[model samples]
Target: MGKKYSDIKEKLQIVVDKKTTNDLAHLTHYFQNHKNGVSQCFRSSATEYLSELHEELNIAEEPNFQYYLPIKWDIPFPPTENPTFKFIDLFAGIGGIRLAYQNNGGKCVFTSEWDTYAKKTYEANFGEVPFGDITQISEKDIPDHDVLLGGFPCQPFSIAGVSKKNSLGRKHGFLDETQGTLFFDIARIIKHKKPKAFMLENVKNLVSHDKKKTFKVIISTLEKLGYNVHFKILNGKHYVPQNRERIIIVGFKKTVFKSKETFEFPDPQESNFVFKDILEPKVDDKYTLSDKLWNYLQEHARKHKAKGNGFGFGLTDLNGISRTISARYYKDGSEVLIPQKGKNPRRLTPRECARLQGFPDKFIIPVSNNQAYKQFGNSVVTPLIQAVAKNIVKELSKINESNQSKIAVHK
Candidate 1:
């Protein structure tokens, strides 16, 4: 019998140090658990690789088929028992959104993410490695899921759609539409799966992108797909020690929810969140900005101020929240630099970044510093996502309750 994810994860714990080995373990885990069986060719290849890995690593013991995951507070975030609903994690960066939904008693049925380093960290923590490159995936093969969760890509759509295309001699067509775009995959999957609900996250600028035409198209697309959509811009500062802001787009199938049924994003609650809460007591000297770099930064800031520009390295106060952490944070930590007494400001440790994003202490950072920074920077605020997911699940529960009541009355 092919090993399940729970079994494969144990084997991987020994060989996951190598990237290629990690990738093998991840792929095997995915195919082993997929509802749609892997094709014979793919299955054989994966199995053969595992067989070689075992021999190469010199394992001599019988396998423990009876594998059980740890509880919620452990290293890996396991699926909830008798989950209330199912969700798919798309563009799943280190699974911050997955953790949020899982806490709300949702099981992840499908996952897709592209970054190799992020996948390493994700598999380390989630057990199953995510399928990659959303554009390459076939929507028909996706399993049926109740809720679709994705933090989709949001490159600004050009405002002069007609003018730009006309100048390039390309007509406004499939190529001009969602073709070759990641959102196209989301649209196609929702059209095929017709999930009961979906929640999407993107940078706050998505609303104003291309002067709102981008958002307009997004809404129209979902409406055309028979879903009623609701959206709001939310700040991570409300739940964590960072001032990250993102927009969440949530929608419900018209068939599952009545036309009059409305959905609201979770209201932000007052939080005593601050940088001091997530800061590490001790950090390596390497994280501290060098004298040369620090001097250059100060000079750059002075020049900017002289020219009436506000651009400068953000020095975070221990008692206050931090500025946004971006993928480029590892380059210099300019956006959320931490101050050191009588010393140059330092960058946040990977662990601090994880905590800032509401990830648990047990969440492993298996990759290097650069990878960790990018992964966390691109990740969602888990507690904030959790609050929104709770509302979504609650609404879904209400629908289920109403349906059951109607069935009982008919009986």
Candidate 2:
């Protein structure tokens, strides 16, 4: 016969006293009244008591203890079959692309973003911190993925930059700038990974940056790397309440490329929102603009209006669309101004800023209001990305089906 209850209890008590004093004392008190000696009956009761205690504590049994483990409730593992297509998010920002793809049944295998604040927000929402500085990472170190997505830095090719390329022949297209020239890193990775597809986002100016030369170079580069590239300018107002405009570029690996499909960017939906849509009804003193600054803006707008120039700030109405929200919005409330009851114009609150960019309320905004403004201003509109991703997935599925048919015939 196996060891008796009382005998096991005595041995366990010695072990417990040495390893866990307080728990042993309490356990011994509960079993102290049992009259059975070191016999099978005592051993059976000790096992039951310990098992019940384990249950109450919600502790997982060690794998080595499986043979002695008692029956208990089990947690169902998440289904892995028919798993979603996996992609990596480069220059992830706040995971705008990741959110878009995830909503469409795609999974993120890896993400990289250098900004610490954006990474914090990305982790808060996606439960994963993005790796930093893509340029420092090796191509071989990246995991295998079917898709690659990024809104790589746009500063090098932005209208604000000097020595900008004016054509595909110029090196300044993306490879020449030192401050924010990271696109070639993306090119190298794509050359090696040969993902089925990739999507890139940038400012609208990128298309016309250098008399169409910049855009031409990008398209030709991807072609040389064996990809069928398609690109278009998409507006956020089409999918959200904001009037932000951006360029979306997509490509399919040359090996998997097929007959081109018409890439229709989603059209703007009827939006009834104005600057008022993102305003706070109750004004906080912190948000109230200084009378001096307000006077300066008003005078500046008047001067610009006199010159027939729309370059200066203007008060937006409650029923009209807003001007584009720029990264410089943090500097002054000049781009999009709101009409106030008796106070000066105020900048949009961080929450309102997030909403303007089509960020869901569940999205985390863990940074300061200024950082939030910059982040959303830089992020791609989620809905627009989703619409474009849908088209890419559709085209890829067709290619995959064709390949399957060919395989079947050969077999």
Candidate 3:
């Protein structure tokens, strides 16, 4: 009923920050349920939350049946008007995957992001601050959902992670790893929630990590949970301008989709993507590297060259794809530097980073440059996720339709 989501956000923020027992996750759940006309699904709790919101807004309690929402609104990336499915985003980094599935008629029922800066940016755009930590939040607290989406931290199974561990002569992957526990958290939630479908993404090397034992545990675990699992190594460059490759795991609950053997990953896009597509029309001078840093990078590259190692800063080719952007990009703009005709190479502006990861221009970057770089570098390519989400929805809907037909026949 509010015009601008900013006002609504402030009001919701008060409720979230209040000293009461309720928290952000509870508020978001109530808001989504209220918006989607499904408050009855959690009747007693919904009524209590509605009363609290009404008191806070200084409004009379309207009938729950009158959960009317505007056909159009003023917020950036407003909630879907009608949702075909409900999803819960775990390890939701600024809600990138949530945005993709929402575009495909999915509603985000729950979200969890731990970083303060990330939560701020997420709230700015989505008007919902994600729950602080997934590990602390019990699976029972999560709202019922049809699909579960998580871009779980890749560091535990990534090339860099394994290399660092191996250099230190420490075990990596499932053994003697803190992050190894997180993967089990996902497994526990899946076993508890038993959502019809799920999608998990990690670095491309996950398939080869620990002599493929890491990936084997993942696949076998899902299969043991009665899921028809499929995974593929997909490069984001096909969908965006960055050459980020991640291994994607898709699964359908065998108990729900009895014919789950038919599940398939999305075919990779054949479209050509280049750096210029995401580059800004005009860039700020602040992005240009200082002479000292530039000189240091050159010397570093020269030293590596002398060693016959191909390690150094990557000067992006305007007509071609770029090296993978990483979380450490902010430390130095070495991974993907852009050349200027009369100036030193520059790091991509925050906006360019967002575009490189397929975030639309409307998506807000309310955080500072440092946080923005980290968020975008760690995010998934939305268009690529969209393509994969479409296939998952198609398979789920087909099974749903078949189930409905069987029910009809019995009736």
- TM-score, every prediction: 0.83, 0.74, 0.89
**Clash pairs of candidate 1?**
none
Off by over 4 Å in 3: 1-3, 12-22, 35-73, 165-171
lDDT of 2 by residue, 178-246 (tens): 634687788899999889889999988788866888778787888888887878887888665567778
Q: How many residue pairs clash per model? A: 0, 10, 0
In order of lDDT, best first, we have: 3, 1, 2
Q: What would the per-residue lDDT of candidate 1 be over residues 1-411, giving only the tens digit for each residue?
A: 334454545654533333544346334444434333323323444556655656766766432222322212234775556777888899998999999998999888778877778877887787666777778778876667899999975423332343456687864323444421577689999999999999999878767765676678888999999998999999988899889888899998888887656567877888898789998877899999999988988899999999998889899989999988877788888888888889888999999999999999999899999989989988999999999999899889999899899999999
TM-score of the candidate numbered 2? Answer: 0.74
- True-vs-predicted CA distance for residue 316, candidate 1, Å: 1.0
lDDT of 3 by residue, 24-114 (tens): 5555456556655544444566456656667777765473424423222355776776688889888888889989999999988778877
Candidate numbers, best TM-score first, in rank order: 3, 1, 2
**Candidate 3 — worst ten consecutive residues by lDDT sum?**
63-72
Better TM-score candidate (1, 3): 3
Q: How does residue 255 of candidate 1 score in lDDT?
A: 85
Candidate 1 runs further than 4 Å off: 1-7, 10-75, 155-180
Model 1 compared with the native: what TM-score?
0.83
